[model samples]
Target chain A: MKLKSLAVICLGLLISACAASNDQAASSGSASGASAGSNSGQLSRDVTTTTSSTFAPGSQEELQASIGDRVFFETDRYDLSPEAQAMAGTWADWMKKHQNVQIEIEGHADERGTREYNLALGARRANTVKDYLTSLGVQANRVSTVSYGTERPDALGSNEEAWAKNRRSVAVVR
Target chain B: MARILKILIPLVLILSAFKPAMSQLRVSVEDGLREPLPIAFAPFVTKNGASPNMGRDLADVAIADLESSRLFRAIDPSAFIQTPAAATIAPRFPDWRQINAQALVVGTVGNEPDGRIRVEFRLWDVLGEVQLVGQAYVTQRENWRRISHLVADTVYKWLTGEKGYFDTRIVYVAESGTADRKVKRLAIMDQDGANHSYLTNGRNLVLTPRFSPSRQEITYMSYAGRRPRVRILNVDTNQDETLGPIDGMTFAPRFSPDGDKLLFSAEQRGNSDVFALDLRSRRRERLTDHPAIDTSPSFSPNQREIVFNSDRGGTPQLYVMSADGGNARRISFGGGRYATPVWSPRGDLIAFTKIEGGQFGIGVMRSDGSNEKMLSQSYFEESPTWAPNGRVIMFFRRTPTDRKGRGGRSRLFIVDVAGGEPREIVTPGDASDPAWSPLSP
Candidate 1:
């Protein structure tokens, strides 16, 4: 009976891995096609996602792998975007699977406003993500938030693409 | 004393000898001297047998002080023809009028039988063709420079209708070394950056040295042994004493308007809170009890209310509370975060740092956080300090390098609170975290 249960767990992992790989391949293929026409020295600048294949035997790895690295925000706002909502859904699923994991949501803003205002904006962004995860069944106690404001930048270049990348919320496992 | 007087007496003589050409000068003393007051300093006419340069030294020091305030446009000495003996010794007013001089300063320096030096001067309103004011003082020759400052202050106040900040001092962290291993020294200087003297050698990191409202003591944060604590240093005595319990990190300290208490922020465990310690009783009372960071506390001019920056709103924002930590209310509701909310000495506005769109800027608003105006925008700027008159503010700006994640340089700058062109204050090296001193006594 124990051997049968272990086989079932392994199969579940395999199926999820296949699903993630298929999604990755599909996204990368579309990204490549989109890059072809926009080669004006900006084609290579793709928002790449790197995920581990082990899958953590549950949805934890899948959720973190999908939304743990990249941040999304609404247009002309420091607030989280719908993409951020979907990302938080993954985090909630991951928290449900791995009840022991705790996470911090770090919010950031683009470099265009006053320092103090940007700090508050970043905090709002992080809290928005944290709130969404809580609503999706993730325990509020397991989620923390911090606002780096415009102090830390993921993309150092001074361009629209760089700014878009910098305006994000990242999930950091604690 | 005689040796020092020998040097000062000759300068005074030259000033009095040339006083006749400056008598008719008139100056506007009200509505803020928008333009520098044009004043003629006639060479002093020495009554006693003294060196020709006798009175010129005293006059020169006074001239330097007034001009450094950037409020006076002094007539060049070459324009003077003859010196008058006293305010009563009048002559060619046209020469001063030709130079468009609005006021004239004439004085005499003579030796007393007691071996002390006696100096006297009069401020003439040339347009009104009358002596507006006159005064006399006796002092040892070593005190001549201070006497010059006092005279300047009197003339400034008489003309501007505002208390002069010229005789004040500024205490700031003199930064050296590199970004990774920085060395900061506590340095004090005349308001115009003259007579700079290092109060503490660069043995540790020091931040925000604030002068006592009485101008006798300074309280600052120093990590002398890698432990952040506040130390009060008496300038006249050169004695330093650490404040209260030293187990936690203490920073952002400023004296109350009354100078009876010190307000500061202390980080115990992981939470930063504002606290006030009575100067005489040495008792500490926590003013903020939030789990989030609460720092940079400043007292209102009346000392009845306090404004500070806190992250209790899930982000840093300016908040005002009673002196006893009652009735806390958020004052900032706009888009961004605010830090270092320093209340102006006049009790009208609060200056702070605002971060938005990846840029740091210095901004000011009403004490209630309305009418917010950003004064300067840069890659990085923080720490807004006010001039005693509440007309100007000083802060620091850092310019990032061309490439990413590289070292940058920072410097001190000043701007009018009304949003004019920002001017950089020249220092010998990279400087940041400036705190303006109260007007000197």
Candidate 2:
């Protein structure tokens, strides 16, 4: 329908609308850029964009589907809350059941603090989960960690809900 | 000192005619930027006509440099009673004064026999009826921008007795993509955002580019390694190399005052600490060792001390310690968190990012942490870097993304240390983490 209207618009203004043709080219270019940004940005104002493909048991997706594979933290705080603690317990049990599975915990922070400051904070948050899992009998060698700091975010918003979700550590089975 | 700076800045200014050409009758640019002293710039003429339009282009560059500082108002060429021909021949003091121009800049762009461009400019004190400063620079034709900046620096030095920051480069992060998944590359440009070029590709993330004192290399954090660590990019050789063998997620790198050592933060199992490494001897010393997160260490001008940010007190705050890593002391006592403390090149004040109530502000304080003042506030401003002269501060400010997180574009801004409106330094795209280089050697 968009192409049909664009074609009609171009045909109607064929002679005088040099601007129309240029606009068509420019609009198509921007359309792709916008889609790419939104594809990677996932920066919607509304929450609930998190989804995964068909989950196979014992896979990361299955772990995420069975019990959330990530734990959120408070702003600038590394200590886990009751909810995060519970999430870590289940993640520990899953790791214990699958002793062959090795995981890399990726830590992240919201885009509120200085870039370097958040790098340290994210590392701490990832280690907080790493230490928790080790205490819960997850092998230390089985669990590695990397901090993306504020470089990556799960949710891309400036609001409280988005920031809360952004401050998280995700367990990825490698 | 502030009073002296005020006396130096006013374009309506105050350099009383004490003698002849020795003390040129130049004026100050005034205290606040609201009423910048009116200065007129004549369209520079090509003497040999070899380089067509380069004279006008060079004059535009110098004018833009002075105007961006918010200290001088460039009077329109249409308002000039004296034409370029007349300006190049002789300065008609009365003609410039007629247009209410206290200062008039006239120049000629000429080509040398050696295929070099010679840029000459003379700053006339219209109010005092004398020439304030005149300089001639001969360099490669492509270096016309640096020559123009030098012209501006000459005028600025004579007018304010403070060195100009025009002939400098800003090494920063050129960002693309979006919030959740972004690509950052090592990028650089002149202080005025000219000759922009990316030094690194987006294959790996790069951030926090700090220029070496020699102006030939930059130290920054890059994820191209096994983990995030410091990497050195030699500007002249166009080569890249990891910093050291001693590494565990190293980041937040800054060069020492003499450019012989590097200060950076390395994290081991979530415990981060500041360390300094002498580049020549390969000797490394831990500056801050604690359970808390300590990073962003910058050397003092004299290199005898260091100012860094640490959260040892339960919150991120500025701290000072000796260059030898002893006697750590907290300096920031504010309501919110403090980070990125950079010492002024003049060895007086320190610039930092202050986060309070969800708003980020670029602020400065004395080395001892007194006389604190906020320069500019925004949604997300971080990483304050000082100009070569320490008269201005540059930082990156990010606007909040929309509901779809579409437009959280980050840009670089420069604010006068004397307090003025923050002006955006236009770049190719979303830019951040600007590190202002020293004046051209």
Best by DockQ: 2
TM-score (0 to 1) of chain B, per candidate? 0.81, 0.92
**Against the true structure, what is each candidate's TM-score?**
0.64, 0.86
Candidate whose lDDT is highest: 2
Kindly report the fnat of each predicted structure, to 2 decimals. Answer: 0.09, 0.77
> After superposition, which runs of candidate 2 have C-alpha atoms over 4 Å from their true positions?
A1-57, B1-30
lDDT of each: 0.67, 0.79
For candidate 2, write residues B1-441 as lDDT tens digits.
111101111111232333336554444533545677788888788887547689889989999999888878899899887788788778787888898987788888787787776777777777777776666667767667777887888778777778888988888999998677688998888899888778888989898999998748899988885378898888777788886675358899999878999999998888899999888898888888899999999999999999999999999999999998899999998679999999999999999999998899999999999999999998999899999998899999999986578889799999988898899999989999999988876
Provide the lDDT at A82 for model 1.
47
- Which candidate gets the maximum TM-score versus the true structure? 2
Q: Candidate 2 lDDT, tens digit per residue, A1-174? A: 222343344444332222322232223222222322323123121112221223344566444433445777777899987656766776676676667888888888998899999999988999999999999888899988888899887666788867876788888877
Q: CA shift at A29, candidate 2, in angstroms?
A: 44
Docking class of 1: incorrect
